[model samples]
Target: MVVGARRVTRLLDAVQLGMVVLVLVAPVAWMVLSAFKPRTEVAALPPRLVFTPTLENFAELFQRTDFLENTVNSLIVAGGSTALGLLLAFPAAFAMSWHRMTWPATATLFARMAPGTLFLLPWLMMFTALGLVGSHLALILTHAVITLPVAIWVLLPYFDALPREIIESAEIDGCRQHQTLLRVALPMVAPGVVVAAILCFVFSWNYFLFALVLSGFDSKTAIVASFNFIGEGVTNWGALMAAATVIALPPLILTLIIQRRLVGGLSAGAVKG
Candidate 1:
């Protein structure tokens, strides 16, 4: 009876894991597969998994669009936002976690939860008035809104998990808050920092709404440029999927490279926070 129960438990666990994998991967698999298919095959009612694949979609993506330039723009904005967000969030998170403050962190959470649209008009007006519209600076600074909270929240528990005795010893040895963070706590929580950076870069890189409204032709990101594949009457699914595949690659590669650290940081955060 015990052996039978154990078999059932294992079977149930396997089924649940398979379900989660299917749910997460189905769309991504379909998109990647569709990226290689011709347009007709992409929209075919039954979907053509066995069809001959072609590179025309990717060819057209590069041939007809400024994909490379947009890719550069995306890299700049995402990289700038991630750097600035980490710079600001690291200290804030350390203070909040070390002091066990909730209100300040909650305030940032509230800011994050608020719709981007809520600030869109004000940001537009403000930037327009300041003559900073259409600038990379504007986008980088604005994208920080999305990246900052992610960095802070991801780093919070890592900071909180630090040993109190070490922190006290550092203080007793005349290490200031910034020195302790830079020389001590920051180095110890390096995994958390990498995880936070990955999350920030991914989120900022793929962010759409703010980019759509705020960005101009020169500053447009690959994500915003990918929308050109859609039209009022007709949509290009093949090329769109191809562009999406390209856009998804960087973040996916980054995450895969550091997946162990990401998983460890997240697991620790869940338990410690």
Candidate 2:
């Protein structure tokens, strides 16, 4: 009886896992499949599970639109913001962890938790005044607000997990704070840094609101440009799906490539040693 019950539990677990995978993967699968489908098949009465794939949508996305340029713009913004966020966050997180300061981290979290809309008007006005509206600089700086807090939070745990004895040893060895951070501590927490950077890049890459409002024609991101496919009365379903597939590629590839490290980094500091 016990053996039979264990089998039933195993079957139930498999079913639950399957359901979760389907829920998470189905939309992505549909988007990719639809990107290859012709326009008629994309919007067919019942979605066509079998159809001859076409490259027309991808061709149109590249030839008829500035999506490639927009993608470059996104790369610039996301990369710049990620770099900027890490530069600032690395020191801040280390200091916070060293000093055992929670309020500052809490404050940054509060800033992050606050509505993105709250800062939009002020950012718009400031950027306009500075003549940076619609520039990559504006988008990068604004996206930093999203990336910075995330980098801080992700790195905080790793910093906390550092050995106090090692840090003190560095200090005794004539290493200044920045020296210790750059030399000793940095190497030890390298995995956490990778995790933080990937998260920051992904967050900044996917952020839509700031880019939409701040970007000009040349600096518009792929995500904002993808929105153009939708119209009041008519939408280009095929092209939209193609654009989505394209836009999703970079982050998707990055995550898949580093998934093991990402998982390890996240779990690394969960328990105190």
Candidate 3:
């Protein structure tokens, strides 16, 4: 009876894991499948699973819009935000985590938890007043608000876990706070930095609210541009899915390529006090 129960438990566990995977994979699989489908097949009443694939959706997506330019905008905004966030967050994270300052870290967490839309109205008003509307600077700075908090959160535990002796040694050598951060702490937390940057880039790239509200024709990102397929009367499912597939590729590729480092960095932080 005991052996039978154990077997049943293992079987249930396997079934649960399979279900979880299916839930996560189903949408992505459908998106990829739809991207290859022709326009008619994309919205067929009874979804067609085995339709002949075509590249026309991609061709039309590029031809009908500034797809390449939007892609460049995404890259620039995401990259700039990630870089700026890292620079701002590194010192702040060090102060909070190394010193065990809970309040500062909590404040950053609060900001991150607040809905993106919560800030939109005020941001729009402020930027409009400053005549900064529709500028790359506006989008990049707004994206930094998201990416900065993330950088701080991800790096905090890593900084907290650093060997106390090394920090003390750096101090003993008469190193200033900034010097210690540059010469000692950052090098030690390089893996965490990489993980944080990758995550920040992904977040900034996919963030739609800020870009949609703040960007103009010259600075619109691929994510906001993807919305063009959804019209008042007719939605182009194939083209929309094609754009989503293309937009998803960069972050997906980056994550897959650095998955090892990302996992290792998180695991290391998990064991830290």
Candidate 4:
């Protein structure tokens, strides 16, 4: 009876897993396939499962638009925001963990939890008044608001898991606060830092509204540029799909490269040792 029950549970789990995969993977698969499909076939009734793939959409994306340039812009903003978030968050998280400062962490969380649109108008006016509208610097700084809270929250658990004796020993060894953070606590939480950085980069890379409102021609992100495919009467579905596929590549590659580490980092703080 127990063996039969176990088999039923396993079968249920497999069914749930397959459903989840289908829901997530189907759209991505369709997008990638459509990126290579001819323009006429993209929205064809009853999609073509067997069709000759072509590079025309990709060529159109690169040659006809500033998508390549916009991709470079996205990279710059995402990388900048990730670095800035880590720099600020690492020490902040360590301090919060060490001192048991819950309020500050809560404040940061509140900022994150608030609708992003809430800050948009204020930021727009402030940047415009500072003559900073349409600059990559503006995008990076605004994106920091998105990345900072994520880094802080992700790293906080890792810092909380640190042994008190290790921190006390560092202090006893004459390491100052900054030195302790930089040399001791920082090294111990390296996995958490990696996870935080990956999340920050992914968030900033995909963020669109800020870039759409603030960016100039020179600083437009690929996500914002992809909107060009949509017009009043005609939507370039194939080209849009191509742009999306390209935009999704960097984060996908980065995640794939560090997948093992990412999984380890996420699970590391789940249980105290």
Candidate 5:
């Protein structure tokens, strides 16, 4: 009787897990399906479970709009911002770890705690004065704020976890501060770097509000361009989904490739053992 009950419990747990997966995945699967289906098939009364897929939506998405340009803009913004975030964050993480300082880390933490829009007006006005409004530089600057804090926060633990003996040894070996960080410390915390990069890339890719407010036609990012699908007369659900599908692809592919490194980045540099 006890064995039978244990088997039933295991079966129930598996069923629950399967149900959760289906619930979460069903809509996304539907969206991928819709991105390929013709308009008529998309809204068919009962829903078409099966149909001949068409490339028309992708073809239209590519040909009708400046989607390729928007994609390029998104790539540049995301890539540049991620690079900026990593550059700024790595040092910040190291400083906080090395000195056990609170103020600098606290200031950065406060920036993350603040609502994103709080900085918008000031940033906009500054950009306007600098003639950076609606430019790639403006967008990159804002996106860097989004990516930087996340990277630092994610990397902090990894930095904290490093062995202090290594640092002492480097000092004993005639290494300068920068050389210690570069040669003695960095190699072991590589996982954290990879994780920070993946996260920075994903956040910058999906960040819409800043891009929406900051970008112009030539510099408009894909997230901002998807806004075009919402018009006064009617909303093109099919095309909107199509645009969304395309917009989501790059980050999805990137995350898949870099996922294994994410955990290491989160835990690297976390402690001095």
Candidate 6:
């Protein structure tokens, strides 16, 4: 009976693991499948698992809109925001770690937890007043709020985990504070920075609300441009899915390439602490 019960538990555990894999893969599989189907086939009363696949949706996505340009815009916004946020957040994270300050970190947490809408109105009004509305700067600035917080938080734990003795040794060796940070501390925390950068890039790339409100025609990201798929006359499901597939490719490829490093980076501070 004990052996029988153990076998039953193992079988149940296998089933649970399979369910978890399905939960994660199902949405992505559906999206890929939708991107290939015809509009009618997508909404076919009884869903068809297989059909005639066509590239017509992709052709339409590229031909009917500025999809390529918007792709470049997403790259710029995400790249720029991640870089700038890292620059600003690194110093702040270092200070917070050095000082052992919790209030400052808590304040950042509060900002992140607050209703996003609450800040939007005032930001819009201020941007409009400054003639910054509908510009890349406005979008970049709003993204910094998101990117900076994430970068700071990710870096904080790593910074705190570093040896105070090492820092003191560097100081004794006549390294200037900033020099120590740049040469000694930063390299040790580089993996954490990379993890923070990846998170920032993904968040900035996927961000819709700020781009939708703040970006002009020249600066609009692929995510906002995909909105064109929803027309007043009719929604083009196939075209929308195709655009989504194309828009998601950059980050997807990016994540796949760096996934190993990202995993390592995330584990760095935890073991040290």
Cα lDDT tens digits, model 3, 155-254, are 8878988998999999999999899999999899998898899999999999999998999888989988877556422277787888899999989988
How well does candidate 1 match the true structure in TM-score terms? 0.86
Query: What TM-score against the true fold does each predicted structure earn?
Result: 0.86, 0.90, 0.87, 0.87, 0.90, 0.88
- Summing lDDT over every window of 10 consecutive residues in candidate 2, give the lowest-scoring window: 227-236
Question: What tens digits encode model 1's per-residue C-alpha lDDT throughout 33-106?
Answer: 99999878899988777988899999988888888889999999999999999999999999888889999878
lDDT of 2 by residue, 67-153 (tens): 889999999999999999999999999999999998988899787888888999999999999999989999999999988999998
Q: Clashes in model 4: which pairs?
A: none
Name the candidate, 1 or 2, with the larger TM-score value: 2
- RMSD per candidate (Å) reads 2.9, 2.6, 2.9, 3.1, 3.2, 3.1
Tens-place lDDT per residue, model 4, 140-257, is 9999999999999889989999999999999999999899988988888998898899989999999988998999989999988877556422277898889889999988987886
List, in order, the clash count of every candidate structure: 0, 1, 0, 0, 17, 0
Off by over 4 Å in 6: 38-40, 231-234, 250-273
Candidate 4's TM-score = 0.87
Model 6: per-residue lDDT, tens digit, 158-238? 998999999999999999989999999999999888888888999899888878778888998999888755643337778
Candidate 1 achieves a global lDDT of 0.90
The TM-score between candidate 5 and the true structure equals 0.90
Cα error, candidate 6, residue 86 (Å): 0.5
Whole-model lDDT per candidate = 0.90, 0.90, 0.89, 0.90, 0.84, 0.86
lDDT string, candidate 5, 148-188, tens digits: 88888778878889988888888998999889888877787
In model 5, the number of clashes is 17
Predicted candidate 3, C-alpha RMSD: 2.9
Candidate 5, superposed: residue stretches over 4 Å from native: 232-235, 258-273
